[model samples]
Every structure is written in C-alpha cells, then in structure tokens.
Target chain A: MYAKEKTGGELSVGGPSVRGMTNAIVVERLVKRFGATTALDGVDLTVAEGSVLGLLGPNGAGKTTVVRVLATLLVADGGRVEVAGLDVGRHADQVRAAIGLTGQYAAVDEYLTGFENLEMVGRLYRLGKRESRKRAGELLERFDLIDAANRPAKTYSGGMRRRLDIAASLINRPRVLFLDEPTTGLDPRSRLAMWEFIAELADGGTTILLTTQYLEEADRLADRMVVIDRGRVIARGTSDELKAQVGGQRLEFTVTDAAVLPRMVERLRPLGVDDPVVDEQARRLSLPVSGGAEVLAEALRLLDGDTSRIFDVGLRRPDLDDVFLALTGRAAEEVASDDDTTAEPAMTGGAR
Target chain B: MSSLAATLSDSVVITKRNLIKVKRVPDLIVFATLSPIMFVLLFRYVFGGAIGGLPPGVSYAEFLLPGIFAQTIVLGSTTTGASIAEDLQKGLIDRFRSLPMARSAVLVGRTVADLGLNAISIVVMGLTGLVVGWRINSSVGEAVTGFLVLLLFAYAVSWLMALVGLLVRTPEVVNNASFIVIFPLTFVANTFVPLESFPSVLRTFAEWNPVSAVVQAARDLFGNTSPLAPVPDAWSLQHPVLYTLIWVVLILAVFVPLSVRGYGRAAGR
Candidate 1:
C-alpha cells in the first residue's frame, strides 16, 4: 500500500527511482512438479521495484508456473517465494494483496457488466462502496471502457475484455503486477494498445513481471529479461546484453543471377564471411559477420560495385529469437509442443 | 473491518458474479423453475388416487407433497456440481484462483447462490402444491423449521456435489456422474409411495430410510396424522431428522476438505 508515486507527465520516460529499490518479487530455487512432469526446476528470479522484468520463454517452459507460484496460486515444492517482503507460503494473503496477476486469458466474468466487474473486484479488496465506485469509474475511463461500462462484459470485444481484465487486477493498486502472456491472442493494434497501457502502469511505479513469447515485445518493453528453457533460467540480462551474448549480426543478400554466385563468393571471401551458404534456386546468399553494416558495404564493393541489380541486401542484429534459439538449442516456436497453435501468430504479428 | 467481514465481502462479490451469470443465461433459471413444477404436476395427477389403501381422509396431494419437497431439493442440489464443472472447464475457476479474494469464497459463494435458486424453486413448487389442495397444517415456526431443514440439506448436498465437480476434469462427466449417483438414491426412498406398499425387504429398509423420516416429520408438523394408526415408534419418525442431520454434518466434514484438496491439486495442475 505504500508504493512510491510516479513523478512526471505520462510520456516523460524516466529511470526508476533509486530510493525504493527493494525487490518486489523474490523467487529462489523454486520447483513445482505436476505428477511426473517437472514444470519448474530450480528457477530463480527477482523483480525490482518500479522496473519491468520480462520472463521470456517458449510455451511449456514454466513461465506461467513461475507467475502462479509468485502470485500464491500454486505452491512450489522445493523453494521459497516472496512478494513485497512477505513469504508467499506463510503470508499468502499479504502476498496476494501486494500482487496483481493477469493470466494468459482474460478472466473477467462475461456475465457481469464492466462496471459491475470492476466494482466486484474493488469490493473483494475490501474497498468501501463509494471508494469502490470511484475506483471503478477511474479504471473504466483509464481503459477506455467508460461508454460500455454499463454493458455486460459478454458484449465487449476481445480487446475491450482484455482491458477490463487488466483494469480489474488494478482494483487495489497492487505493488507488483504479473502479466502472463497478456497479449497472446489479441490483434496487432489491440496488442500495441495493451502494451502502451502496461508501459503506463510501469511508469506509474508499479513493478511489472511479464511473461511473453513475443521477442519484439520483450525487446520493446522489458528493462531486463530472463529466458527460460526446459524449466531452467538459461539466460538473463537486458535485451541488448542477451542479444550480444548470441554474437554478431547476420548479413543476407539476393543476387540477380545464379551464374554470378561463384564469382561473388570468391570476391567476398576476404571480407570475413564465415560459413557462406548460397541458395541457387532463390539466388540468395547469407553469411554471419561481426560488423553488419561495414561487412555489407565491403562485400558490395567487392561485387564490382554493382548495387543496382542487387535484389535484396540487409543487415540484422541478433534478436531475442536468435538468443532464445542459441541458448535453448531449438527455436521458441518449435519448443511449444503442447500448443499446436504455432507461435508464428505472436511472432509475425505484434505482441498479439 | 474484521476478518469475517472481509471474508463475507469477498463471498458476496463472487455471489454477485454468479448471479449475473444466471441472469445472462436465463434458460438456467427457467429450467430450474420448470423442472420441479413439472415433477409436482406429473406425480400429483398421474400417480395420485391410484396408490390404493390410502387413509380415510388423506388426499394424494397431502401424501405426495413432503416427498416432492425432498425431491426438489435433491434435484436442485445437483446443479451445484454441474455449474462448478462448467466453470472449471471454461477456466472461470482458474480465473478466481488468480484473484486475491478469500480461498473459501469460491465454493462458498457458489453453494450459497445455488441455495438461493433452490429456495426459489421450492417456494414455486410449494405454491403449486397449494393450488392442488395441499397445505402446510403446521405452525409458522414449524414450517420455518422444516424449510430450514430442507435448505440445510440442500446446502450440504451442494457442497458434496461441488467436491465432485472439483475432482472431475470434464463438465459432461460431472453432469452424468452426479445424476447417476443421485437418481437411485432419491428413487429408492418413499418419495412416490409408502414403504408399506413395497416388497418386504424394501419396506424394512424404507422404514429406516432418512427420506422416509423427512416425509414423516413433514407430515407430523403439517397435521397429516398417519392413517396407519399404528405408526412406527416415535424413534422411527425421529430417525429421519437425525439421519438427515448426520448426513449434513458428515457431508460437510468430508466434502469441505475434499473440495479444498481438489482445489489444491487443480492449482498445481
């Protein structure tokens, strides 16, 4: 209840306040098993106050399980979990009070009006009637649901329902917020709106712990990220740091003629093109290089400076996807075996 | 506010949510209301006046009303399991689990909501009984006591069903399982005819049956003095009340823990 207040306009991005650097969530060696399957295996994570920590992992990689344990919904068999300095097991109610959780799916009651849903959550947090109504109104307006506030949630669109669900979790203004794949099924535009809303919450000094399969989402919003694989924390750092760990950029190009492949390869051999691979059918050439832009320019110069006929040329830094693949030995989308619904939807689109 | 107040507030919110759900799907309430009414009408007209050897002044309406009361509560209580199973299947229970409300509020709210719906159906059926010449001859206090007993029975039964719902993975399984288990239990009792009219072994069991005791207690309170003249000893009539009480306590004792344990397992899953 004594969370620090944010200072500045909505768009004014500022660093986290250093005075309240206390950890909002602390999970150490947490392990949970469902019968024979180990859902979480010695996972350790800490979320600092006012910072957004993204838990990036493939499906079935225990991201949701970790959130559940920290939220006091599921008990860990082998480790300690604390929220806002309260132990999750011993002080579950306090932990619950201190944290808000938005699961993968929107969990608001479809039958209740949006206003009723917010009011219900407020009352559950023990707010007085007037206070609950005021808070509900504030949330409705914040989520842009004020006009449809009186309508049953069943009538709301997918994005509207998601916003309502997120609003419901904020009824008590929890110190820590856990969003588990919050933007999974939303459309691109809706996902961006939800991301902005989450960014605003973080800017408002709420410690947010988000789990998402979208690499771009993690890259965009996470101040720091932890990549988990097979129930273990495989990598942890800021997005750039993790990407740096996976090594240099990738250089890709498409030549106009397949007959020029050998000559181009020979010309670019001196530019430190390691493991150059050519697709004759697509007339594409790809190679990993240390300095992306410099290497591309040099390779172009070596090709007789004929850049006009080049079909495609690009340089890309190592993305979260590459980092994930490098650490886990498999693509994120491929690891989600249980959910046949491909991760492509979340990847190709926005965070949706 | 006190902890009890906090718990009550949480339960009230959940109850409000469930009530909204019932409102959205009006068919649920419609079916709940019509089922008991149809049962009363069908039993009163089709089976009444043909059970032969009725007491001198006893009408079929008077004889069947008590049994129908028990029948209605028992039937209505099964919805507890069905609704919970549906919620679980739809991830509604999982959503509730993620909330910061009291843990017991989820099941308690559901049972309470079902009890409210059951009471409405019971009252409607009672009116139908009155229209057919059946009446409560007892004092207001006795009538209230009888109603409380029926409600308590329904609550306990709902908790038992809630446990079943929690344990089962699928809604269809829960629906089929509860009905399968409850139908024979309700039918074997003296709901349709007196135990004396049954075969010798069944008659003996039915005399000791708790359903029979509930019917007899309702009859005694309603001033429908037994025409058999030589009613079984006072202990036999009192056994139903005692048996039903024991059942209520036993169910709470077993199912409350079962429900919690089932919830714990589900959360782990």
Candidate 2:
C-alpha cells in the first residue's frame, strides 16, 4: 500500500518500443546443465524497464530454467544474469529485494491463511508489523481474495491460490517480477482473471518477465517476446513481429483423392508464397500466402480442373498455435504430459 | 553484533511462520501427542514385564523411563528433517530462498520449532510415565538437568536430520532414511535392555553407544540408575553425562554448517 505508482512514459500494452529506458533484466550467453542434459545454452535476452518480456518455448525449451537463474533460485552454469542492474548470482540478496518471483507452481504456504501468507512474506521483506498487516490487507482486497482471506490457502480454488501467490510477490512492491507459467493448470476462467490482474500490474509500470508454453498467454501479456526451444533462442520480437515470422495467413485445402495431392501442390505453388506443406495421410495441403481472399481466388482459378474434388478450403491468419507448430514443428501441448506437464515444462531436452 | 541481531530477528520471523503452520492445523499437535501416548501405553503394558523388568532395585516402569525419554526425544528429531524436506518439495523453501533475509533463517527456524515440538511431546510422555508409576527420586534441580540434557542431545540429532533432509530427494525419503538409521542407532544400544543381559559383543556396544550414554546419564540424574549404574567396563558409560555432552557438541559442530550450506543446492527436490 505504501508503494508509489508513476504516471506518464506509458506505452500501450501491445507496443514494445524500448528506445531510451534501461533494461530491467539483461541476460547474456546464459547456460545451465543438468547432468548430461543442457537446459539453457547461450541464451541472451533484455527486458526494458517498465515492460513485460514473455519467454516462450515448448517442453524442454529452457524457459523455466532461465526464470530460475534470473530469480536467483538456481545458479547458472555459465554466462551472466542481472535483475534490475544487480547481478543475480553475486548480489543475490539485493536482487531478491528488488524482484518478486511466482515460480512455475504456486509457492504460497498452503497451511497458512491467505492473509497470513501475504503478511508472512511482508515480514520476510522486513516490513514492520503494522505496515505488514496493512499491506497484506490492501493486497488481499485488491486481489479480490478478502472473502477467503482468513481461510487456509489450500481451501482456496486454483485461481485464488494463484492470485494469492502473485499478491505475495507484490508485498515489497518489487521493481521486477518473475512469473513462470502463472496460469499453467488453471481453468479458462481463472486463467483469464490472472491475465487481467497481470495486465494491471504492467499497466502500473512494474517490469515483468513471464514464461509460458501457452503461446497465447505470452502473446496477450508480453510486450516483447522471445521464443526458446531446445535451450536456444530461436526467435525474438514483439507479438506482431513474432506473428509476422510465420508470414501472413495460411491457405489450406483437402483434395477428395489422396493420389491427386502432388498434382494439387504443383498447381498451388505459383499462388503460394512458400512451398505448400502436404499431409498425405490427411489428404491436406497448406501454403503460406501474403494475400488473404485474393490468394484463395487465384488458387481456385488455378486448380479449377476438379473444383468438385475439393472437400475443404479456407484462408485464415496464423494464430499462436500455428506459430508454435511452424517454429518448433510440434504443437505446444504435445511437449507437456500430465506427469511433467504441471511441473517444469521444459526440463528435458531430447526425451520425454 | 548487528549481524547477530539480524540473524536472530530473521530467525524469529521464520520461526513464527513455522509455528503458525502448527497452530493453523492443530491436527499436527494432536498427531505429535498421539505417538507418545501410544509408545507409553505399549511399552508399559505390552513389553513391560520383559524389557522393563531387567534393571534391579527399581520397578520396570521407573527403570524404563530414562530410556523412553531418550528414544522419544531422539525420534522427535526425525520430524525436523522431514519437515524441512516437505518445505523443499512444497516450494516454501524456494519462497524463503528468494527473500532478502538471513541465509540460515529457514533452517534455524525449522530446528527451533521442532525443538519446541519435541519439548511438548516430552512433557506429555513424562506425565504418561508418571501415571505408570515412574517417579523422579532425585531433586528438582537434577530432574531439570536430566530433561535439559535429553533435549540438547535431541537438538543435536535434529541438525543431522536437517542435513539429511536437504540432501535427500523428498520428504518421504527423509522419513525412511531416519527410520533406517535411528532405529538401529537407538535400539542397538541399551535403550530397551540392560547391558549385562546382552551377549559379550552386544554388551560392549550397549556400553559405548551414545544413545546408551544419554539414557544412562538421564537415569543417573533422575536417581533411577540400576545398582550397576557406573558400567565400569566402558569409559562412556562410566561418565554418561560427560560423554553424551561430547556427542551433542560434536554432532552440532558437524551438521549445522552442512545443512545450511546444503540448502542452497538442494532445490532440485
């Protein structure tokens, strides 16, 4: 409650233009290995002050590893990491004071009441008794957890537990916050509530670095995004820029005959921006194209030999799911199984 | 001095949080009390005539009191290790690690809370022992010293468990590991039987075991020692009080630093 909020110098949620401000998080050539597996390999990233950078990747993508290193929870095997200008490994205590971390799982004390959890974190932050209670009360009210404030956190729903987790992180009003998959296992309703709450924090000028296998989560929350797969940064840009990487919309059509797929591909090549991807098993062919409806019109005119033979055809913009598949050649959900899914999303590199 | 104050203050805050966990869930307190109640009833009625009857010049219940105290308090230390491991698995340790507080606060707080919990169980068991005709023949000062020594030794054992808890994979592993080690460590000594009743090699082990020294020391202080209280064959049994104190200090010296240092690297759990 005592934390101050600044005005002006605010950028829109989607715009990630960081021309002048100092970066809150600077990570360069970071590497972390577990036994024989490398979790992070030569990864580099910078998040501007008062901006949100979403670390995006599939399972075994090293997103959570990067978060742990920046939060000072784990030591990096190599490279450098600094949070709010303090080196995480060297000035850990100071970096700890400046930042709040909501790990991949909700880290709130389940045995303690929601109010007690926030108050305890406040005391850990060295806030005096009265100030701690006051801040805890304010946060509980702000997170809409005042109704269940006195109940043990274990009794709260998944969404409430996550809200309390985030509220605890804000106890010290940290300059930067690390949220690793803040909405990983939540129902859609709770996940949306969490997204709005996080959006509010960023709007208030707190710098944030969040990691998620949910591409849409990163797309909605992060101003600048970096995609890491197999412990390497494969792509980095704004949400729009990352979307642009896959290039416009995809045009897909299903041919009635599986035998005619190759012939259809040759006829569609001239209309496509890139070579069409053929799924012979599904009798489907999809090509990336710059134009939307016009590309479809030309494709139908070009492949008019057997218009009746086409079962399905459509043109649509590439969503995050398509981006993930395009970049990593696998769906995001495929990387996370029920066992290791809710835990660390990206711990293993090569195998399940 | 300021650093000392900071460490103490941070430890106090952490201790308060840990204690609150017990308070919020009074089931933990009830569970802690239940085990001591079970032990007292079982040892008094079931194994009383045989194991409890070996010592001379005192009733089996009275003679068995010191051994019970030593065993109960030592087993209580296992809770310390298990609780720390549980905290690690639950991500509470990660939360504490990310805080700008003293590095040793979490472990210190956990051990102190476990110590407090152990003391409660001791009092509960002491009352149960009294109901079964166990008496303190010694003066109040000596009785206090006896209980204090048992607590100190238990606290030392807790540090060892704390280190084990940090290095292990899970809280369940800590429970299993403590049972494997503590059961043999406490049972192989003169905890349940008199040294003279054991075979030759077993008698020597019973005479020199630190658990035996702790029990013998408590019995001497409580004025419930057998006629052969001195156990002159072994130096440890001869000076039970001094030997137990030496073991206490030695374990504390080795384990406190190891647990604290291990906390940093133990996050994989």
Q: What is the DockQ of each candidate?
A: 0.48, 0.74
Candidate 1 Cα outliers beyond 4 Å, as residue runs: A1-20, A251-272, A276-321, A340-343, A346-352, B53-56, B90-95, B98-100, B200-209, B229-238, B260-269
lDDT of 1 at A22: 74
User: B59-152 in candidate 1: lDDT tens per residue?
Assistant: 7788788788887787788888877877777656766676666778888899999999888887888899899988887799888877777788
The alpha-carbon lDDT assigned to residue A5 of candidate 2 equals 10
Clash total of candidate 1? 0
lDDT of each: 0.77, 0.82
TM-score of every model versus the real structure: 0.86, 0.88
Worst 10 residues of 2 chain A by lDDT: A1-10
